[model samples]
Target: MDFHHVSVLLQESVEALNIKPDGIYADGTLGGGGHSYRICERLGNNGKLIGIDQDSNAIAAAAQRLKEYESKVIFVNDNFANIKSILDKVEMNAIDGAIMDLGVSSHQLDEGQRGFSYQHDAPLDMRMDRRNTLTAKSIVNEYSEEEIRKIIFEYGEEKWAKRIANFIVQHRQTAPIETTGELVEIIKRAVPAGARRDGPHPAKRTFQAIRIAVNDELGILETAIRDFVDVLKVGGRLAIITFHSLEDRIVKQTYNSLSSGCECPPQFPICICNKKPIVKLVNRKPRLPSEQELEENPRARSSKLRVLEKL
Candidate 1:
């Protein structure tokens, strides 16, 4: 399958960066170079763009897609969580701006063999980085029922997680759960028919939860925010587009933590911690895609763009 991903919140995210013609920038998620390409377009020959992705497929596609500006583009096959080291290797102490769009690409979901979609009847493998040993197969067949339940409930926000976990455990005991189809069947059985009839595909939440757990999507997020803040030059912007509530929450909290100054209690008259706000939230609220953008790309509906500028 071609590594294709429609960049969500395209214009909003790039504009939030406030691009400088000669400035250095980073696309931490670099999905098909959508945002990076636009950033490059606004840059002069002196500008630089660092693109990073854990998936080799994404790396190759982005490299090819943005080859026109190869002179200013640097690609890396690595997780965005390691942005600090990525920037370090390039000898970059600071960047003018950065962007992170935390959404699974369309290609990943469309490719049945990748096993990211519940609709696809493929092996239970949802490793964003194929090099990783852990997969959805092991999470389904090996993890304890309680653990699975926790993941689904916490990560997926699925109310039927307990029942789904129970069903998976029972079925796997007879035979190891080996495929996405098998898992979907179990989820369907676990959820009540009436409830399943109401909203979404019966297996969507479980699949999302399993994929997130397999990849540790929520892990390293807060640290990444701090790292981005550290590398951003004063007035440099950090724009993030998150697809789901969990990702949005983390970004919001991290931005607030970094932008909020003074750790001292309200009653205290004198300053103690000596903390100062490092960044300012560009907007009090996240920016949503325009109605036209959502109409053009339905996948963009859930996207919310949040920006922060270094103090």
Candidate 2:
């Protein structure tokens, strides 16, 4: 299958970055190089772009797409959470802007074999890197019922988390949940008929929860935000596009906490902790995709772009 993904909030995110013709930029989740291509187009000969992705497919497709601008582009196969170390290895002290588009890419879902979508009946393998030891199969079949419930509730925001976890644990005991179809059946059994009909697939949230746990998506996002902000030069920007509320919340909270000047007590007359704001939010609210973009690609519907500029 072709490694294809329509970059979410493409123009909006690049605009949020406020790219400079001669400055350095990084696309930490360079999916199919959609946004990265646009960034490279706006750059001068002196400008540089570092595209990083853990998925080998993304790296290959992006490399081919960006070959014309090869002199100005560098590609790496790694997770965005290692942005700081990546920049250091590339001899970049600080970048002018960075972008992170979090969530499973459209390619991962549409490919069918990657097992990111419950709509697909492939093997239960949702490892983003394909190199990771942990797989959705292990997460679904081996995790304790309580742990499964926690993941579904916290990561997936599924109201039927406990029931779903219980069902999974009960069913998997008969045999290991080895395929997406098997898990989907379990989820269908757990959710009420009316509830399942009203919304998305009954297994959607559970699949999301399992994939996230397998990849440590949320944990990586939390760790990456601080490092990404630290690597930004004064006045540099970090624009993140998140596809789910949990991911959006992390980006929003991280931006807010960094932009907040100090955490000192209200009663304190003089400053003591001396914590300073690192970045200022470009917009108080996240930028959502326009109606036009949504019409063109339904996957862009849940995306929210948040931007922060280094202080």
Candidate 3:
């Protein structure tokens, strides 16, 4: 399938990066090259862009989309968690800015074979990187009920996690849960009818939780945020767009920690715990999509963009 993803907060994110004509930048989530293409447009010949994504399909789509700027673009087929190593291999000491959009691209959800969305029926596979051994199927068929419940509750924040996990455990005993359709049916049965009648689809949370567990999405974020900041040069900006509260909370807390000047206890007037601020918030709060953008692309509705600059 042709990889297609509508970039969320396109203009806002690029402008936040504050692209310099001859500065280096990185698009850590490089889905469909939407953000990367915009960065490339703002760059001079001396400027370069390192676009990285774990999805091979994303990389391929980005490469083709950015073919016009091939000379200035370098693509990497690895997770952005290793931003330091990625930059090191290219002999880049530091970058002027970076952008990370934490939402799964539309293509991933739309392509049924990838099995990211509960809307479609396919194999229970949600590995962002096809190379990974652990998949949604493995987690569904293999994990203990307690373990499954924990992931759904903690990761998905689904109030019906207990019932859902119990249902999954019960179903798998009869036969291995092998497809998204089968899993969706189980989720429908687990969530109460009144609850299922309202809000988003009943299967949304469970699928999200399973996908997160399979890919370790939340697990790698905090450290990656700090690491990305470490390699940023003075005045460098890191703009992250998160689709849900979980990642937004992580980014908010991490950025606040780095930007906070002191960690001294309230009573300590002696000025101990002399932690200095490393970065400043580019925006006091996260940026949301405009009314027009939301109408044009409903998927952009939940996205929250947070930008921080190295001091």
Candidate 4:
């Protein structure tokens, strides 16, 4: 499948950056260069954009899409979690702005062979970066039922996680669950028919849980957000678009932590810890996509764009 991802909240995120004509910027999740293209368009000749993505395919596609601004663009095929080190390597101490859109690309789900979608019957390999050895197959086949249940319950927020884990274990005992189809079937069998009838696809939550586990999606997030904040120049903005509640919660809490001041107790007469706010929330609440944007792309339905400016 072609590397294609419709940028969610494109205009809102770019505008939130408050882009300077000659300022340096970073598109931390430069999928297909959707946001980067707009950023590059607004940049003067002296302006620069550091486009980063863990997926090599995304980097390549983004490169082609932003070819006109090649002189202004620097592509890095690395995870945004490594933002600090990446900036260090590039010898950039600070960036004017940055954006992170945390959502799986359309290509990943559409391309059945990549195994990100339960609707597709393919080998269970959901590694966002192919270089990583860990895949959905290993998690499904090797993880203990308790561990699986915890992931499904906590990460997926699926109420039937226990039964799903039980079914997976039972089926794998006969033969290792090698494909998404097998896992989907196991999930369908595990979830009661009446329960499945009401909500999304029977296997959606379990599949989401397995994919998250395989990539450790939530593990590096908090640190990554802090790292991104650490690299922003004063007055620089960081806009993040989170697709699900889990990601949005982390982003919100991290922003709150970074932008909060003095943790001293209310009864304290004087300040002690000296904790000062590092950033200010650009918007008290996250910005949602407009009705037009949602109509154009339903995948962005859950996206919430939160922005913060460095103090």
Q: Which candidate gets the maximum TM-score versus the true structure?
A: 3
Candidates in order: C-alpha RMSD to true structure: 1.0, 1.1, 0.8, 1.0
Query: What ranges in model 2 sit over 4 Å off?
Result: none
Q: Tens digits of per-residue lDDT for model 1 on 1-311?
A: 36788988888889999999999999999878899999999999999999999888888988889989999998988998888899889988899999998858888899899899988899999998999999999998899999999999998999999999999999988999998998888999999999999988989888888888999999878998998898889999999999889989999999998988899999999989899999999999999989999898998988899999999
Residues 1-311 of candidate 3 have per-residue lDDT tens digits of 48899999999999999899999999999989999999999999999999999999999999999999999999999999999999888899899999999958899999999989998889999989999999999998999999999999998999999999999999999999999999999999999999988999998888888888998999999999999999999999999999999989999999999999878888987877878999999999989999999999999888999999999
> Could you estimate the TM-score for every candidate?
0.98, 0.97, 0.99, 0.98
Runs off by more than 4 Å, candidate 3: none
Relative to the true structure, candidate 1 reaches a TM of: 0.98
Query: Per-residue lDDT for 61 in model 1?
Result: 89
lDDT of 4 by residue, 1-311 (tens): 27878888999999999999999999988888999999999999999999999988889888889999999999998999999889998888899999998868887888789899988899999988999999998888898999999999998999999999998888889999899888888888999999989978988888888788888888989999998888889999999999889989999999999999999999999999899999999999889999999899999899999999999
Q: Between which residue pairs do clashes occur in model 3?
A: none
lDDT measured at residue 186 in model 1 versus the true structure, 0 to 100? 90
Misplaced by over 4 Å in model 1 are none
User: Comparing candidate 3 with candidate 4, which one achieves the higher lDDT?
Assistant: 3
Model 3: per-residue Cα lDDT at residue 76: 92
lDDT against the true structure, each candidate: 0.91, 0.91, 0.93, 0.91
Clashing pairs in 1: none
